[model samples]
Target: MKLPRSIRVIERGWLSANNIVLEERSEAVVVDSGYVAHAPQTLALLERALAGKKLARLVNTHCHSDHMGGNAAIQKKFGCAISIPQGEAPAIDNWDEQQLILAVADQRAQAFSYDDTFRDGDVLQMGGLDWQVIAAPGHDTHAVMFHSPEARVLISGDALWENGFGVVFPQLFGRETALAETRATLEAVGRLDVDVVIPGHGPPFGDAGAALERAFHRLEGYEQDIARLARHCAKVMLSFSLLEKRSMPLAELPAYVARVPILAELNSRYLRMTHAAMAEWLVNELERAGAAGRREGLLLARGE
Candidate 1:
């Protein structure tokens, strides 16, 4: 990887977001602590990487549980100052799990406080490099990406990935302009002179141009039929659920889907199928796509 000598990448699997640790002399910055389920692992990685120095600050590209779920554990451990997108400060301050998508999807995140907020065009300095904060609003309305012109590096938080980007939650909630926002975000990323991209999920990739091309092509395909986009979101949520729970009894899948407000809402708006039908369809789709498999009336999330 062409990363700074001071930066270390912690590659996490699907359920937990990747963590980037940038150490500079007396200061250390950790970005996007993984899911709470993996907090212990995250802490271990940070401890080994930091050696004995305390973590100075924590930054979240967005407030998604996978991205910031480890915040409480990390903050408690290091007493680090936290920074997050300015738009989500209200929901964080109020601890609205519902608004945070925690209650709706039954996702978990321990509450943590942020001491500072960043907006689009703001500059953040870490590891002796200045990163420009760029707004990226489709995936999560308040998401942002950090770009280091000096290093030709872009920390793309769900805006652009090696394969595809994150699910556009805003679109499933009837925000028609969300897809357009995603397109705009992609365009903004395309305009950057990037050499390496540190994505929110997968490992860092070198060919930024190729990734942007793939992302734009997928964006165009989704634009043709919004329902197709909705179906993608449903599968993503289902896969995430499967990732969380290694396996679930066949009979419980529908009830499980029905219990998740966000999944049910997506089905109501797009799939429009009953819980049983939707469950079967989602599972079938996953199996067909080779992302999951059914064994003895139980669904297992396939390892990627």
Candidate 2:
């Protein structure tokens, strides 16, 4: 969906994030090329917008597989210089596939090279405009937001959203301060004159203040949920056993909580977290929240 003036939003569904195509002086720059599946469409959108003009630069908010999945593709197609967030540089430089890959285990992410780095307060001249870099790191430590202060526009990369924000899986990898950091990050983003917000996920919003407010509230609930689940005993084993039995059929409602790695490891140690445990916990959680009903050894999720 093309926005007014120089910004266009190219939706990539699940693989790549929605591409933000910025235009300037008939030349162009694309923000967040998205996943590998999105490279062709991203390139196509850029070609259509630029009409064969040079794609001046390729910038990433961070180096997640979803956001930078098309980085190599765009670099190959346009021969553009790729600049990502500074925190993302080392991770991308080494390319730990599992670390880079979205929702995956241990597989090292394929290594890709970036030409430069983006830091907070940096200005990127694109689409006949200058976009100021706004580093916000609730989702990924390295993630950065782009702002067109003149337009009161912000491209928030998984930091702020209409309803909620990204998961805090990185904390499991030893970053204890991640949640605290996320809270502080939100504080910074709230200070911006963001009349419009284009998040890494979901539709763009005109009232970013309202969006941020909703996200903040959701974050409180989400954090409480995560913490609550973490403290429970045998939760991981229960989740796994239940998921393994009925996971194939119930794809939409994820039975497994991948972010809770500690619980996953615990499942391996104590086999008490059995199928029955999972079934009980799931049913109990649902029952507690009034979102599910138990009937004949089966639990049904609530209909919206």
Candidate 3:
């Protein structure tokens, strides 16, 4: 059934993402405009929700392309001032393709002018209520979560969810300590006295406490794998040594011998080590163990 147009959810389904619209008086404030593919639908939603009113402000939790995809479309249409978290001003301002999350496709995005900066403890008044800015890392290192205390609502950007957190690929992209910082942020979020959680991906969860508990429990198990990786860093170190002898791109290596997931996951966790360092660990560990061999610039496995 079609939900009432009030504060309608623009569920762009997949390619576009979702957007949250706030209607105040005749005016509106749209948050996280999804993607360019979803721009038309977002505008249509705004048209009905605004009811002849204009969009006063456009804001984003962080600068992920998907979150800010419709920025230009909205800006051109309503000419509203755009605001984002202070942590990601530069990337958001320039729309730097490399740093706007792990965008698999190499594509530049439409530019949007930045008007304001948000930080932790700051309140963004939307819909006649103050939405507090809460730092939420892990998914995007500079991401921020929005909280509206009066409504007990939280706009959790890829941080806490009904199941678990997003991929900790920020390290591969450049952000260090992404997982650690995210864990700390999630723990803090779990403690908040709230009733609903509107995450970046899942449906709005009414039982915030129970959802938070499940998220934390998932964190615990993930942490154990992280610890095991740290203790077994020598394994990856040895593997890279084999690859070094060949000279292949990282992606060409065999599954069992390649440092695709394991080492990448470790590097993402440490957040402190560079890809070069992480590569060194994998090569050294696997090469010496004879598990991997360097062949024609490619890292391959001796068996399986």
Query: Local distance difference test, per candidate?
Result: 0.88, 0.65, 0.65
State, as a TM-score between 0 and 1, how close model 3 is to the true structure: 0.69
lDDT of 2 at 130: 77
State every prediction's TM-score relative to the real structure.
0.96, 0.75, 0.69
lDDT of 1 by residue, 21-121 (tens): 88888779999998888899999999998898778999999998899999999999989999999988998999988767787876888899899999999
RMSD (Cα, Å) for all candidates, in order, is 1.4, 6.3, 9.6
**Per TM-score, what order, best first?**
1, 2, 3
Please give the range of 10 consecutive residues that has the lowest summed lDDT in model 2.
244-253
RMSD of 3: 9.6
Q: Which stretches of candidate 2 lie over 4 Å from their true place?
A: 1-4, 101-110, 228-304
Best by TM-score: 1
- TM match of model 2 to true structure: 0.75
